[model samples]
Target chain A: MKPSISCKFNRFDLLLSLFVVLAAAALALFFLSHAGGEAGEVSIRDGDNAPYSLTLDAPRRVQLADGHITLVIERGGVYVEYADCPTQDCVRTGKITRTGESIVCLPNRVVVTLEGAGEFDAVTG
Target chain B: MKRTLAALFLTLLLCSCGAPREPESVQFFAMDTLMTITCTEEDLDAVHHAMREIARLDALLSRTREESAVSALNRGETVEDAELAALLTRAAKLCKATGGAFDVTVAPVVSAWGFTADEYRVPTQEEITALLTHVGAGGIGSDGEVTTLAEGVSVDLGGIGKGYASDCAARVFKEENVSGALAALGGNIYAHGTKSDGSPWRVAVRDPFDGSAYVGALSLTDAFAVTSGGYERYFESGGKTYHHIIDPATGYPAESGLASVTVVCGEGLLADALSTALYVMGEAKAIEFYRTFEEPFDMILVTQDGRVVLTEGAAALWDTSVAEHSYQYETINKL
Candidate 1:
């Protein structure tokens, strides 16, 4: 007894379905590989006037003011706190969620970058 | 089912084979340029030794040298040492390059202004000109290991010392066969290769107006980047600003549109000197000076207006996304 055309078509459909699943898996993996390249953050200090610190708060408020800046930590990742300038750029630099993220204020000249919280042996004496 | 299993195994095998290997980590400090060498732990001792050597060079070439070798030369004494000989030779070249703008012999003026210590009081014009009369590159001369100085003259190589140290440390990296590393002394930076991930090291240029902000980023591989700014040391009095980098001619702090100058070049010595020269020359002359030379250096000049000017090469290496804030691209070369 010979198989019907419908039965043959069903077998082909199953093979096609398997191929689609395998390709999807590979695509997902490629995305992950690219995503892994996202790296550590860097903090830049402007060495002029009064030295102000711009710290990364995972999530919270940012304040900018006259040669002074503070980062109010709202949540756990990163955010800007204090600044006393007209632009309030530091305050506008919302939250830093990722591992290597930054918040920068130009008017006050503060930059806060996150690079894996742990200090890697680069000590200055 | 067997065929499908074979295909799956092959895919896994290919993925594993194509995975990227981890990169090495190298570390050290000199010329305010902290170096991190990424290599095997087997190379750690060599790296440490090289770093200490660099620090020693720093002590020798620094303003502290007033107590070290430069003082001996200043007091009509002759001293022939490997460190002093090398430093004096480099000083001569830098002095010529800046057309006397980057003189190592300006220490007498530096001291007269009371900037050598924490004393930040502004000096009177008479006091500055009196000292300037004795400070110039031609004040000191070397005759094959024998250094002689004119009366009432002193030399200060602090402006160019860290850069020289950085260059020497880079040589150590090369001699030790380091594949990749970065040295950053405060704002001075040198690199032998990219990070383990094969991306160029990105250095931030600080804004001169506000110390807490960055002007922009400079991406470099196997190069050096050094910055000099007015705010490094200064005191404000009587509604006037006084900075550290003084004009060799006027015996007063240099005033220009540039807030800071960052030079990227092959050696730390050049980066160090050029950064200072540009600081003194300001934006216009700095751009002209950079263009006149055929060297492979790129410069980032930040003006007091928060404007940024980059050499064509530097612009290509920078991360444009962050540069948009508090910075507008300015090509001062045409102006």
Candidate 2:
């Protein structure tokens, strides 16, 4: 006669397995959310001061270097609206919409860089 | 079974906890450009120290700063700073190595073109000729402690300052025992170590023709790479375009038939100087130089004729999958 075996999971076992599954899922989601380059933010560095970041979800005009520089964020694009620096190279950079692009005003010691996931860590030219 | 499941979950959590933390980045302006240094959060102090070091060098080396040692030398004063003297000596050596293709004594010509003051004017041929008289490595003199310049000659370290600054940052990183770091001082880049994930840092070579795209990317670790291109600084006047990389030979923009040149080596200063020198050397001569130079260095040359040429060493780490398909690619092996 063939013997038949039956296995049963208790309430504690089922709860424990479910908890493990949920916890793993939660960890995966957390990592996915915190991955680099997903956040479309604009980072501005002025001299030795602390860097400032702004989300690109809205349009805004930001004055920097005590009104010496005027930065504009419009329609997911960033550009230098006005700069009192002599070179005006910052203003000539035009608008940067993609990640990794930057406008640097050497005289003012201001660098406005677009932060997100870029193809390369740095650009050399 | 329940115990096994619990152990697995615990292991997963521990693995997640052990993963590398986010890097702390410090950005500032120095050497007349934007500089960004990134390292582990625990090594943030080292980054700050590096910044201070770069600032000190800038104060000492800046040509525009009246109190700088360079300014003193430019004023015909024998500046007695050992650091400045050493740098001047090194600059002279590099200028000689490139057969005077790159010279720090081209400062007057650069100023005459209005590039230094941003006045934006095309200097007359006669004016350039006069300025060229002062443009040569021999114009700088040093006695290992004091530095001097010829009567009409001045020096501008703009071509190599950023590279040397990156070298300073690398020195700091090494002293602090930082795990991994990347310092980008304008077009000069020094990769201290691999990324936290153990992968090499990826640096893209900007396309000379297209400001928005890149010609290729290089994976680097513990290396210095510098790219020189006319596209970075230029002006258009009277239907003519003028760039800042003046050929010391001609007192004018280098018309070497090459758009850009990237030099990769172990030393940041060498990489920086060679990039400019090679760009001025053009394609054929640059390749010949690469084959004959005793020091090991890799190079990438983007020519005006839509060709991307890479030295054998550079080709090993180059990734052209994302490069513009319009340009044909070539690799140069030692002949």
Candidate 3:
């Protein structure tokens, strides 16, 4: 006689378990094939100054004007934590989510934009 | 039995990942351009050492730096830097080969055009003619141990200095057992060896007009690629676009009708010099230059007429499918 452990599971139950496993496998496959690239960079520009590229993986705060404006990076996004600008547009702009997206603070003359997270060896330009 | 077979398959798959991690990278600004050095994470110390070596070379080569070798020689002092002497000797040979098209002594003309100081202006014909008097490789003298410059002539290694520094950094990386390293000093690139995963490294050629996109990719291993273009640095004065690449003959920016030129060679210094030389030579003469040139290199010339020209042998080195389709790809036969 087969063990009671095997008898506890009938054909229908086994089929249901198999269906669940198959669904999870399909979802995993979908994610593997369709997941977008991660946030690779955050480029910042202040006023008429040159743009600065920084790594998005590391979390840090950028203090400018003796902490008048605070730029923070968290969870692969960069957004202003505080700003002394009159309108507070940068602080209200919230987080950046995708490559090519940007948050601009006109009064502070600050710009934070996202760039594609590519696996390039080196950029020629 | 089926589970045992599955476990065996998993073990085989795990053993196949010989180089699972991407090479580590370090970026910094020097030589008035952004430089990036990439290698395995364990070779971080070696990368730092290489960057220091590059900084030393930058100080020694910068013409404006007060105590630099070029500046000292310009001040009529017999400077004693082995690297400077070597560079001068090489520059002399390049100038002779290109018939002064590639001249380090063109610093006077370059400055006269206001490019060196970044205060762009259109110099008068008389001003350029007078500056051209001091703009030839003949004004430089190197005696294998010392370097000197003639009066009014200054050495600007802007063309080849970055390449030399890349080569220097490469040597340091090799000494430190970092075989899979790539150093990009501005528009110059040097691949130290095969990739860490034992595959050829893929490098791209950028479109002169479009900075963000690449025109094509090259499969390089133990090679150097350098490009010189007028698109990146230029100023408009009175409806005229004056670029930084001054033609020693005309005492003006090269009107060779070329947007850019990229040279692939085994030596970084040679590639750097060749890229500028080809751009100055333009299309017709550059084709002639390539046929008779003895050095082994592949050339890619982007023209102002919307043409992309390549040396006859470049087909094997580039990715054909991903090449830019906007411009027709033309190949010149070796004359």
RMSD of each: 8.2, 3.7, 7.8
Tens-digit per-residue lDDT, B1-335, candidate 2: 76776657774985586455676677777767778887888888999999999999999989888998888888989889898888889999988888898788999998988888778789899999888888898999899898888899899998888888888889999999988998998879999998787889899998888766789999999999999999888888899988889999998899999999999999998899899999998998898888888889999999999999999999999999878658899998998
lDDT of 3 by residue, A22-125 (tens): 65556555443332367777887765667789898888998754567898976678888998754454665567665544566644556676765243455453
Distance (Å) between predicted and true CA of A34, model 1?
14
DockQ of each: 0.08, 0.44, 0.14
lDDT of candidates 1 onward, in order: 0.64, 0.86, 0.77
Two-way TM-score contest, 2 vs 3, winner: 2
Q: What ordering of candidates by DockQ runs from best to worst? A: 2, 3, 1
Candidate 3 lDDT at A46 equals: 67
Off by over 4 Å in 2: A1-33, A36-39, A46-51, A61-70, A81-86, B1-4, B7-19
What ordering of candidates by lDDT runs from best to worst? 2, 3, 1
- What would the per-residue lDDT of candidate 1 be over residues A55-119, giving only the tens digit for each residue? 43344444434438766543344556556654444455465543334455554445554444221
| Clash count in backbone of candidate 2 | 1
